[model samples]
Target: MPRPRYLLALAGLLFAGLAAALASAPRDAGSQVFSPRAVVPMVARDEGAPPPPPATPTPFAPTATPTPRPPTATPTAAQPTPTPRPPTATPTPAPSGLRLQGVNWYVNTTGTIYVMGIVVNGLSTPVELVRINVRFYNASGQLLATDTTYADVSIIPAGGSSPFWTLLLNPPPGVASVEAVLGTYSVSSRPPITGLTPTVTNIYRSSSIALRVVGTVRNDSSATYQFTRVIAAYVDSAGYVIRIETDYLEPSTLAPGQQGTFEAIFFNAPAGLETNNLLIWTTASR
Candidate 1:
């Protein structure tokens, strides 16, 4: 009996010792109980963080420079003007010499007379004649008649000439001889007429108190001619010297082999004059 009670007390002691060791040992798992009235704060911190550095401000730089420009120029003006031109002038000419050579005279019993001649000298070149003067004289040196004639006469050409003739008739009583003189005023160088023969045709006086006369004259010249102051004279039955009328004839231009006729009509003459006693006279230009 005693042994069994002793063993039971040892077992109870061993079991209490074991229970105290277990309460003091390290445990892998544990449980805890929290009260509702208790407050707990939890703060989270990052591990291994770097410290913050201080701040610094940056500085400003300078600006660039501009370039310079050049200058410009100006303009100018103009001037004035002038005028134009004109024209020129000219001149005049001169005169010339004589163209005639000679004169001739003839008479008839019926109171008819004739004069003939030719142009013997002149310019070798052709020219014109403008005027002529002539005079007639009788045997007593008495002036029977005077005349002025005009015509265009050509000069003796290089190898040629012109001929001229005139007629006169019916002389004053006691006048037996007759003469003729000629003058040429203007002439140029040209051919003239040569070798002309003249003939007197008739002479008569009108039967009137005034004793007017009529006569015929001719030109046998080869070239043209002109005559002025043609006249006729006569003696009347009363022994009075009678002077008849005068007039101008057509300008006479005689071509080769041409003939011209001239008539003289007179005024202021003596009365009862015989026709057979009448005489005519003329001067011509060549």
Candidate 2:
């Protein structure tokens, strides 16, 4: 039992190279070990086979599961903002009737300020567009001038009355007192814009026109009037209204019994104006 000597010459040189590779193999080369060119031996395999069975695993070609990659237009975090729409509102208008009755104020001699008025249709119907607002104060109160006037009667007949005036000329240096109210009015059931009918006798005075008026407008109803306004109010001796005028009737149309003629001149009359303390009105329209 003694073996050594290079392991007995390496087992006789691996038994003479496996008998010279079974005498140059082939005769069914041991069934080519499941041939296919003897399963690739590339000229000289120096003994390689087991590693080949692993290659048959290529049947696991299941790599097609990559289709789930579609939601990426650049966004990996932070996203949430969408909500805005709300704004559209406008509706306001509702207020009518309430104060302005016989207010008065006068000042003249160059500062000229008169806020005369009279609007009284104390309900029971009939009233029409009676705007008239005046302000102008300053006796330690502030606010100095603002005037708007209207209401020379276009329809006031329920107790009837209408006449308004407003004027302010260069006043605002502590102009002292004034505040006539009522602005914007309405309560009409029609009828009373009449067909014109006014008459203010004829009066005169002039030292450069300090009051003078003459009027006529007459188209007594049957409808056929037009424009024709002739307002006029010039009282004093304490009735306030020191000259309010609006004239125009040289032919402001009138035809159902025609008659028209108007001429007025009142250069701020005040101090004792008496042509019967005047007040005339006329308005037309069919």
Candidate 3:
């Protein structure tokens, strides 16, 4: 026994409930799916931008300033130069007082000519080492030969004379005249050695080759006289020199007031001579 109206009402309520449930249900799975880009982060970039500068630190302490220095001075005046000097000169000696006198010549048969002359010292001092020059000439005044000779007297006193002789071995032709010249002379400034005398004895012609003369010399001076020399000269009747000879005293020295004997020989004498004259002279050291 159920009623019909109740049945129909129950059917209507069921259909209405079904329709609300269908409208209120969840959506489909295909419509809820997501994209890959939506989960990551992103940034935006600009076109023109300037870079930032590096940072600098500040100083801790203060700085100090530097000081200047002064300048030095220079000198102006310089040193002076020195000067040079000149040299000096020396002087020379003057000529002496001496002269020549009486030149003579003689010829023998053997063509040997003998030349003789005299030297005179006019100065206040004595003359030593006298040299004489003999020049031979012809009748036409042309020079033939020139000869030199020394006086046998080593020292001639003031205002005194000394004899000189030379032998020409072989003379040239036309020798008619001769001239004597004073070649050289030396005067002593020292004091004179005086008081010497010579004596001739035993005089003879020993053959024709020689004339022998023996003599003695005496020294009358106060001082000792050394190296005394004695000379002798022979002349013919015509007053021309024929021969000359020299000799030295023995011991070669004479003390105060001493005498010594000597002998001399002259060679080449002419034969048969009629008359002859002899002269003697003496010299000694100072």
> lDDT values of the candidates?
0.40, 0.63, 0.65
Better of 2 and 3 by lDDT: 3
Candidate 2: residue pairs that collide:
none
Error of 1 at 200 (Å): 24
lDDT of the structure predicted as candidate 2:
0.63
Clashing pairs in 3: none
Worst lDDT window (10 residues) for model 1? Answer: 34-43
Error of 3 at 51 (Å): 99
Q: What stretches of model 3 exceed 4 Å from their correct place?
A: 1-99, 108-111, 236-239, 271-274
Error of 3 at 100 (Å): 3.6
Q: After superposition, how far is residue 63 of candidate 1 from its true place, in Å?
A: 99
Which 10 consecutive positions of candidate 2 have the poorest summed lDDT? 33-42
Q: Number of clashes in model 3?
A: 0
Q: Give one digit per residue, the lDDT tens place, for model 1 in 1-286.
A: 5799899999999999999999999853212111111111111111111111223666665475556555564435554545545645555422222234323333433554433333333334543343334455544556666544443223444323333444444545443333323343333543344433333465455544333333334455555555433544443333222333344444355444554455655332323334425534444456
